[model samples]
Target: MSSENRTAGSGRLLTGLAWAVLLLGLWLWGREITDGSESGSSAPTTGDVAAVGRPPGVALPAAHKPLKPAKPQRVDVPSIGVTAPVVARGLDTQGAIEPPPYETPHTVGWYGNGIEPGAPGTALFVGHVDTETKPAVFYGLSAAKPGERIRVTRADGTIAVFTIDDVQVFKRDRFDAQKAYGPRDKSRAELRLITCGGAFDRKTRGYTANVVVSAYLTGVAEPRAG
Candidate 1:
C-alpha cells in the first residue's frame, strides 16, 4: 500500500438520472471505483456542539484490531453529528452492489455479500453525497479526520467502534476500485465510508472525484439504547 494521503476539494455535479445509474453501477463485479462527488468541507452540526469539524491533517492512528462477525443496523459519527440507518444491499441486475434508492436519500447501503462490519476485513459502506434537492447522508464526510470515532450499532445490541485513519479523494480517471475497496489490514476489522467528492464539472454533468474515509475497528461496547 502507498504511504501517502491525498487532500480533497470541490462538490457535486450528478444529474438525477445519471446519479442513479452511476451509483447502481458502482459495485459491478471486478470493477473499480468509476465515479462520485460531494460538497466541500463544512462544519458538522449533527452530533454534540463540541463535535465540530476538524482539518484532515497529517495524523494516523494505531493499527486496527479485528473482531467477531456481526450484522450492522445503524451508524453514528458524533464528531460530524451523523446518525443514520443502514440497509443491506446486493448487486443490481448489472452486477453492481446496488445503492439505496433516491427516495431514501438519508440511508446508507452496506454490501450484503461482503464481510460484516466487525469481521476481520474491510467492511464497505457507501452513501450518496447529494441529491437533486439537497445533500445526502454522507454529504459532510469530507470533514472527517483521523482519530475520530465511528460507531456502528449492530443487530446484536453491541456497538463496533472504529477509529478514523485516513481520508482521500481520488479523481475519477485515477480511481482504483481494487485499492479503494481492498482491505488494507486483512485481519483487522476495517471500514470505508465512501461518497462522491472533488470538483464538479458542469460540462460532464458528474463529479470529478470520489471521497473515501478509511477507518478500522478499535473496540466494542454495549451502551444502553435510548
Candidate 2:
C-alpha cells in the first residue's frame, strides 16, 4: 500500500480500537447497575475539585410535559458560562456513540439515535473536558449545582428549559452507565451532560472518572419574534 493509504488504514484501526474499549466500559457499567454487585464508591468531583451536590432545602422545579421531538441546535449553561453548538453524532461502526472531533472541542455531541432533547426520554450529550493544551467546553461542568438551569435550543424554534438535580462523578473503574444515562423518570424529558472528570492519568492518557450532570425539563420558552 502507498504511504497515504497505509496512514489512512492505521487511523481507522486506532479509532475502531478506541471505540471498542469504550463499548466494553459501557457494558461493564450496565452490568454493575443491573446486578448491583459492584463494590467501589464513586466520589463526586470535577477537575480535581469536590463538586456540589444537591443540598438540603434546595427544591427543584417540577417536570414539564414532554414536547414533540426536535433536533437540538445549541446548549447553554449559564451557571458555568457554557454556550456551545450542538452537532448530531451517531454510533461508530462498532456501535459505540462517537464524540465530537477533537478539532472542534467547543462543540457538543448529541446522541442522534436516542430521544430528542424535548422528548420523553433521556437525551445524551457529551463534550470534551480539555484538549492537550486547554480546557474544552465542559471543563467546568462539575461546578454546576442543583437548581441551576440548562437551556437547549431546538430546531423547532422552541427552547427546552431543564433544571439540574444531580451532579456525579463515576470512577471509570466502576462507572454505572445505566444509572448515568438512563432516564430518571420515564415520563419526563431528561438530559445528561457528560465529560471527563477527576484527575488525568498520564499512564492511560485518560481521565480517572466521568462527570455526569443530570437535568429534567421543567419549562419551555417560545421562540423570539423575528
Top TM-score hit = 2
Q: Tens digit of lDDT per residue, candidate 1, span 88-191?
A: 88766665566777678789888776768888777878787776546678879878887889999998788999988767765566556655666786667889
lDDT of 2 at 77: 99
Candidate 1: minimum summed lDDT over ten consecutive residues — where? 1-10
RMSD of each candidate relative to the true structure: 9.7, 8.3
| Residue 84 Cα positional deviation in candidate 1, in Å, after optimal superposition | 0.2
lDDT of all predictions? 0.67, 0.72
| lDDT (Cα, tens digit) per residue for candidate 2, span 1-226 | 1233223322222232233236534653455532212211124543432445889999988899999889999999999999999998776665466778867878998877567898887788888766554567887888888999999999999999999999887666666556777678888889988877655544565566777889999999987788
Give stretches of model 2 more than 4 Å off: 1-51
* Backbone clashes in model 2: 0
How does each model score on TM-score?
0.75, 0.80
Stretches of candidate 1 off by over 4 Å are: 1-28, 31-64
Best by lDDT: 2
